[model samples]
Target: MNLRRLKYFVKVVDIGSMTQAADVLHIAQPALSQQLATLEGEVRQQLLVRTKRGVTPTEAGKVLYGHAQLILRQCDQARVDMDAAGRGLSGAVAVGLAPGTAAAGLALPLLRTVRARHPGVLLYLNETYGSTLSELVMNGRMDLAVLYGGRVAVHGLQFLPLLKEQLFVVGPASLPAPPEHVPLRLLGEMDLYLARPYNVVRKMVDEAFAGIGLAPRVVAEIESASTLTAVIADGLGATILPESMARTVVGACKAWQCRIIEPVIEAPLALCQSDHLPLTEPAQAIKEILLELVAALPGSLIAGDDTRLSVS
Candidate 1:
């Protein structure tokens, strides 16, 4: 099948209308429709169902769409590689950032660095929960990720240790100030609001409590950082998170408060990528930039008296 025809068919399925796809592809509607017909003919299967409402892919079309997407991405990458053969670093690199401090602080600076240093490079960033980011990186959807604790062997991905971030007990300003440093037992005793078990930070928190034979009094399981902060700020309950997250949350509404955890439960941040697929040149450059940036983060964001971990 022709790559151009496959691309046209994929575009049509994506937009669900030949006319709209034609407008985006800058090809005439009839020509686009003809390419789809040719693609279906080559496959000897009906790919799309046309209707007045719009177009929907048939089962065969759906399968073809998945393969077509990968093919087109590879084609684009090939073009980029060829264009950058003897020139400066130029290509697309996708990096994933875990939803808390990494997303809150790192993205803007990383984007600026990419723009200033490698103007030819295109960076796509995904900011989400660590679990999602892990899956994306392992499945070849994301090139790299900055996330919290996880096994180095999971999904055959490489997890290079970055730095540990201290967890803090955050509450509303209306509540009486707890000690500057709160104990794990005290944290467990309080009505705590935390992320669900799927979150990497939540897993770390759970494991830390379980390690000391304590069952935390979690009053709510929330997935959204904003919602958790809002609830804690409204005096609903207290939550535990990194200092950077606390700063971001309280920056918006000054009613939130935080205290460093005594004996300090620290979450190890790691840079992860699939070892099966080697990093491209541009990806490697961006990775180095991220590592440098993480190393230079202020002491407030870095756990006090904590040493950075290095792992190849």
Candidate 2:
């Protein structure tokens, strides 16, 4: 079987649509279809079940898909290994980041470090919600991701705790001071603006409130950190955030008042990757750099208080 054809088939199954796969592969639909036909002919088995919405792998296709991923990853690793002989590690590595995960401080620094030290290696970064990042890492779309350790379902992924950040109740500075820390049950009295339930922080907040026999009095369900910050700073409502995120992404540290939750809710930033797929050299190098950088952050941000409980 042609490796190129196998690659194309894998892309089709990954995208779950012939048209979408053709678009991503930068080839005509007819040419892509011809390639798939040739692949099935060589294997003598139907691989995909076509449907109006998209395509799904047949039972046989499911088996091949797993092997195809390993084969493709190995082929890429082989090229990177050969290139490392003189060119320093060389290949592409994609990493996903959860939103409000300090991309401003982490992503740019990571890019600069890779460019300066490993000129031949290419780094691609994607920033999205924690749930989305989790799915990407689990599906092998991302080589690795930094996500909430508690929120992720780690069926096929390995999660390593990097740091634990305490969540704070952020509000306008003009508001009355809520002591050094506010009780979790007291959060029900505030005009809370929070992300929807799908968000990691929201899930944690819900559970924390439930544990205390109270529900947050949410006035708004906002997904954008900027909007949440703006509204909260304007005295519209209050929101919860990690210390690092409040200091970096949310900015206006002086304008907003942050009170630690009484029973601190610290979410861990975990490095997650597929358990079945080994990291390529380029990916491993990048991972090391990320770990080292995070290790240097303020004690408040890198606190490993719950590191022992974050293993997955």
Candidate 3:
């Protein structure tokens, strides 16, 4: 079928509602429905199962969805290949890093590596929350994302487990030096400022607290790294972070970091990209360099308990 119709179908499935997809596509709902009917006539099979909540792919739709994703990705790649015919590997590759995570440290190194390897290529680096980066990658706006939460099962995206980062509790410099290893309950007893629940580290912290049948005394849900750093500097509260990010935060705010002990928690770091989208030659080169840099991260920050991390 035509690429336009396939795109419409994919958008509808991604959004899970005909009306919503039509709005997003800037088309009338009747026109979108007719397109779907035409697609069904061509395939001779009903593709979607509609319900009050939304629409889900039927068994036949499931099979087509997989193939459609591949086909769409292949077409996109073909365009890139044509554009780069005389240019040698060159194009824009957007990469997203989760702010306040160890991935933030990767920005400079990634920039340097890509520049040295492919001077002709353009690299766009963005730092934001992990969930937002993942969304951009799924929508094909970003080529790659280095983010926490590899252990999450996100639709339309693939995660390549890179490494695990040890969790640490950080506080202002004026506070007393904590025990060599701090207990989770000790932090629970104090006021804390932390990332929003969508953050993988936040999710881990919440789950750890839940294991003890209690919740953390989070006074604020701070999403921006600058905001978190400013609050920590003022001694508003202490929060948990991965080893590298914790060190980065503490360095900025004159704070101290100590590993948590009661139940050691680690967040999985991963290279995220669209499952069906093949990387361009330039992007592939950059991705390889990124992996090399990640593999060279300091041993102290890497989690010792696991050989690899995965969603349970």
Candidate 4:
């Protein structure tokens, strides 16, 4: 089957109309329709059903759509890789990172190293949640990603454990000190600013609370770690975040970092990529730089086999 024809079919299904798909593809409507028909014949099934509103995918079309998306993404990656090979030290590397993971001081150093080592390479960063990042990597939208937790069991992906991060309870300096180590119960009573449910931090927090048989009362939800810290600084509410995130901007906040001891919360930091995906020169270079950055982080900040660091 022609890859171009499959692309046309996918585009038509996406737009729900051959006319619109043709316009987007800059081809005549008849040509686009003929291509779709030819693709349907090749598949030996009715891929789309025409309706008064627009075209809707048949059951077989839905399955083909999924495969088509993957094929097209791989094709795009191949083109990018070839183009990069043609230009010395030049290519594109797309990286997706969880919100606080970037703030934890990995993103900048990695980008800088890539720039210095491969001046022609284009670095693209996407700040996203763990699940979203995982999906992007699996689908070839991103060459690599830094995820907050341990190896997520996504098919065709390989995860390298980088570090284990501890969670900390942060509050305005004005808030009274609870103790050397704060109890989980204390956090339940305080107004809290939390990440949305999709975030790895939120999952960790929920698990911690579950261990203690309590649910936290969240006063606000913010997506960005920087914004969460800024809000905490303004005395909006206290929050539980990775120590890596707290330390990253500790100088700017009027916040006190305290240990949450009742149920210790820790999650692994990992570098992930599709196992079957071949890295371009630029991607490989960036990966090496990322490993270097991970190595440079303070050992005290990372989880050790024998010792678990407390948030305080």
Query: Who wins the lDDT comparison?
Result: 3
Q: Please list the residue runs of candidate 2 whose C-alpha ends up more than 4 Å from where it truly belongs after superposition.
A: 10-35, 41-44, 49-70, 102-104, 150-153, 300-310
lDDT of 4: 0.77
Cα misplacement distance, residue 210 of candidate 1 (Å) = 3.8
lDDT of 3 at 88: 68
Ordered by lDDT, highest first, the candidates read: 3, 1, 2, 4
Error of 2 at 166 (Å): 1.0
Query: TM-score per candidate, in order?
Result: 0.75, 0.80, 0.73, 0.84
RMSD of each: 4.9, 4.3, 6.1, 4.9
Give me the displacement of residue 42 in model 4, in angstroms.
0.8
Writing each residue's lDDT as its tens digit, candidate 3 over 216-276 gives 9989898877888888899887888898878888889789899997899988888888876
- The regions of model 3 sitting more than 4 angstroms off are 1-77, 299-312
Which pairs of residues collide in candidate 3?
none
Per-candidate clash tally: 0, 0, 0, 0
* lDDT digits (tens) for residues 1-312 of candidate 2: 788998998999989999999999999999999999989999999998999999999999999887788688788778668867766788888888887765335788889999999888889989888778877777676888877664455678777777677888777776775766777777689998888997777888888888888889988899887787778667776788877676653365435546566577977777778777778888888887777677777642444333222344
Say which prediction, candidate 1 or candidate 4, comes out ahead on lDDT.
1
Report how far off residue 67 is in candidate 1 (Å).
Answer: 3.7
The 10 consecutive residues of candidate 1 with the worst lDDT sum are 300-309
TM-score of 3: 0.73
lDDT of 3 at 227: 85
Residue 129 Cα positional deviation in candidate 4, in Å, after optimal superposition:
1.3
